[model samples]
Target chain A: MSWRDGIVLSLRSVVRRPARTALTIAAVALGTGLLVALASIAVIAETRVIAQLGKGGPATAITVDANVVDPAQIDSDTPRLGTAKPINAETLRSVKQLPHVSTVTTVQSQDVYVLPPPIGSALSGYTGDDPDRGLARPYSDSAIGIDFKQANNLPITVLAGRLPAEGSTSEVAVTLGYFDHVHLDPNKPAAVLGQVIEIGSPQVSPDGQTIRGRWSRGVIIGVVAQDLGSGGLVTSSTLTNAQRAWQLAGGDGNSFGLPLPASTYSSLVVVADSLDTIHTVRSEITALGFATTAPEHLIASVQRYLQVVDMVLGAIGVIALLIAALGITNALLAAVRERRREIGVLKAIGAHDRDVLRWFLVEALICGVSGGLIGTAFGIATIAVVSHIVNDYLVSQGLLGVDLGGAPVATSLIGVAGAAVLALIAAAWPALRAARLPAREAVGAL
Target chain B: MLGSDAVARGVAVSVRGLQHEYGRGRHAVPVLRGLDFDIEAGSHVALQGPSGAGKSTLLSLLGGLEPIREGEIWIGETRLRGLRRGELAEYRSRVIGFVFQHFGLLDVLTARENVMLALSLAGIPLQQRMRRADEILDDVGLTDRAGHRPQQLSGGEQQRVAIARALSSRPHLLLADEPTGNLDEESAERVLDVLERLRVDNGCTLVVVTHNPMVAARATHRLHLREGRLAPELVGEPA
Candidate 1:
């Protein structure tokens, strides 16, 4: 029979068994929907990260370090300074002078203490200097650092006041928790922003000896209102002020020797001119003996993880699709049996064997295509449901700095195409059964 | 004016020394033994017999739906007994029309659609199959019922659609197995009239197998079958 007639006839036949058709369609939808949802999460996660990284700088950029070496042993050699190295200003200056260096900055974190009866008897408040200021208070007992300009580029949002000036030794910024711990009276005009506070050094060394260190007093210029919960803190200043404070806090010469070698910052943020330049810049930096990468590379790494996840998900989905296909095959075979007397009648009336074969095959194709369309729609709705949960988790955890709706375009397209392929795959066995039926045998089937 | 040789020369279907047996060895049940017949083109014939006389089986062999066990059966130049399965199918599509007692119109299709399927399977062009389907339905008195599916039509109407489908390809021969066996007298006469007119209009050789004497009486000739062998031919009243 002509393809059109075959299609029409087949469609009509499928429509006759409404419940069976609906069940098959639902089966496809379940598989496709789960696949689409999982895929969308992966895409959204990648999108959020890349957006953050891109905001921080260009795509092709690198940080250079003279003391760059394996990080695993840096702690054993230097004692537990709490996990990150203080990259020296001289090293940063040298890299700043390197060719194609768009911008360069330095930061370091160290411990300090804040005095005055501790809030709720739980040790609170951070006393630290900007890495560029090098002002250290050994008494206050908190994380302190000279914040690089890059810190302002951080994904964290500021709640109140303003950023500390480029070279201001008279100011400091504290997270919202820092203010909470000090028990400072917010109603008192002088207790909140612009409040002058005395900062002191910590009580003892890692060896447990109470000893004197450096101290400084500065006004609070900005308060980061986020409750980061991780207790990470930052402070910043100009390069010259940082040098003076370093000298005051026992740093010697441009090469400050530590109990171990002072290597480099724990992580580096670099910006390249464009997406295309990221690879070239990364390779160039790698040649210079530094590990380097960009947002897309990190994204690719995440995608590799997603690929494994998808395989597991797809395997699960395929089983469901297969079950649906078997159902369709069963129904079609049943149709063949029930229609046997009719088949005999047709053959008796000049209907050829091929006519019967074509009729049944057309029926199968109709089921496949219809099920595919239904499944695709279901998958998109599924993605929407799952993405809501995933996005909420990300926002609540601060992983995603902002809420993004649904998923990217490519992710949705992949879902639809995948469903269509699955439907066609499921139709093969039934189509074969239909195409091979002999007129005599088929007529006898009943 | 015509002798048996002239009549045999005019035959659209000829079967000689036909034999059919089921199974093998000790279990072989002979179904047909040495049957012979010549049906002239444009003539209507009815085969009458008891249930086990192999009326259906003989019709099947004659229509090229089954292989012959022995001897020869020919429809025009295409050898029904000697042809391969594919060639036989092609022959059937081009030369034979069939109407079963149960009226085998596809239940899912409208009357017009059922007729179109036959023309389509015969390799008629897409545009022409529809028109031919319409014409055949009209000729079978099913024009007013074109849009009705098999279940929606009466038994007589369903059988009419079946006849339309069978003849839509304009086959050279019509093979009916009790075309009126399932119908009441009024419906049977109506169906028989349609079949007679179709045979005349198409110059088709028509064969009907039935136990109904009235149906047999309308045939141009009658063949009495007893256990698959044809009795001496009997002249029947014309339709």
Candidate 2:
């Protein structure tokens, strides 16, 4: 028989028993829908996490800190009371000369007292010589000093305005965490732009009995998202100038009661030539008597965990599909049993065994195709709704919302094709049974 | 009214020492044991017998519904023995047609679709099979009931639809096993008349398995069976 004829016969047979056919298709649709949704969700999750890590820095970037006596305190931003090999200018030049070391930027961190902008003022928050009396509030925060020209190499996400311009000692950029500290609205970061704030450096009296603040005033030019390290960003020159003023005001200088050395920096951010050389470069830096940390190791660990999640989700989908396949086999078997005489009639009308087999297989294929398409649509809709709900929750928790993109086309195709192949397999035994039935016995003429 | 040149000449049937049995080994019970007979081409033969006379068994072997176990049976130039499963199916489709007592019409199909199904199975194209199905339905006086399913049609109409299906492929040999067995008297008469008219008009060989005297009398010749073999006195006699 021709394939067209076989399809017609099978379609008629399927339509003849609508209830049974619908139920079988529903089972397959549910299985396919669940598989598509779970697989798409896993893919979207991996993309979002990788995107988040990408915002921090390239995998080739590594952080180098002083070799502290306490290993547990390594990479910590807080000052420790231990003699350590400081990351000085000489160390920076040596690391820059090492193989695979592309670039190095020095970083300095220090505690500062910040006075907030006035309630209603122009760009300059100063009302008179006493800018503290015109402030809305006061907050204590740490200031991170780095080369403004190398700011792009560090992990900084600017939400609004621009970063401190190169070599602008009076300019600074606050972090989103700064909003909570100084009672500013983080949702509208632009409102805080162009507002002036004061960074105070403490100085000791001659008798070493009292301390006073020697403040350096600057304007906020931008807002940034927090990264692995704490504190807002300022130019290294600005920090040096503030310390010089405090020292000139009779400060005790360094904690060791010695002159503040311009050669020493708290840490160094080292960039490797490529991701492949990050390990080698970090080891070389450690050999230079420093502790190094690479974000690639953390990213790799996160990817491994996501892979496990993806496998678990995929297995769940496969299990559901297998159960649906069994349902198809059972339904087709019952159809064969009920249509024994009909099969005999077809055979007696001169249908070959393969023709009979094709007829039943076509019926199964129809159900599978229909179910697969419907399931793919369902899965896409589910992903959209789930993404929306999750984004709402994230926004409510004061975190940036994420967008889970559409379902992958290759995944949908695989799901539909898998369903078709499985349906054909499920119908094979029953179709064979129908084809092998004796025409005489089935027609009841024996 | 049906016009198709696919089967222009009727096929003559010859059976020689044909032996068929049920089961295997010691549990075997023989049917159509060593039966030998011949029906001329285009001749209408009535096959009559009492219960357990193996008349249906003979008809089945003749129709290629069952395997020929011992001896050979020939239809035209093709021998039944040693034919593969696919070849036998082809023979059944192209060389012969069968009308069963139960009508054997699929309930899901309309009367016209039932007829078109046979032509479709014979590898006829879609438009041609549809045209042939309508023509055969008209020949059986079921043109108006073409759209009706089996449940909607009476027993006689259903049997006539079966006849239309049997003749859709224009087979050279037509086999009827109690075609009017389930019909009322008037329905049976109408069904018999349609069968006889189609047989004559198409010039195809007709073999009817029946116990009714009226059915036997209408045939050009009659054969009666007793037990597993043909009765001596009723062999090859004019009805």
Q: Highest lDDT: give the candidate number.
A: 2
Error of 2 at A443 (Å): 2.1
Per-residue CA lDDT of model 1 for A336-435, tens digit only, reads 6666666655554445556667667556555555555565566667766766775556444434334435656676676566655555555555445544
Output the number of the DockQ-best candidate. Answer: 2
Q: Per-residue lDDT tens digits of candidate 1, residues B87-198? A: 7777777788888777777778899988887786678997798788888888988788999998999999998988888788888888888889789999999999998898
Chain B vs. true chain B: TM-score per candidate: 0.93, 0.94
TM-score of each: 0.70, 0.72
Model 1: runs farther than 4 Å from truth?
Answer: A35-268, A271-308, A344-357, A398-430, A441-446, B1-8, B233-239
For TM-score, the strongest prediction is 2
Q: CA lDDT of each candidate?
A: 0.61, 0.77
Model 2 spans with C-alpha error above 4 angstroms:
A45-48, A51-137, A142-225, A232-294, A385-402, B1-11
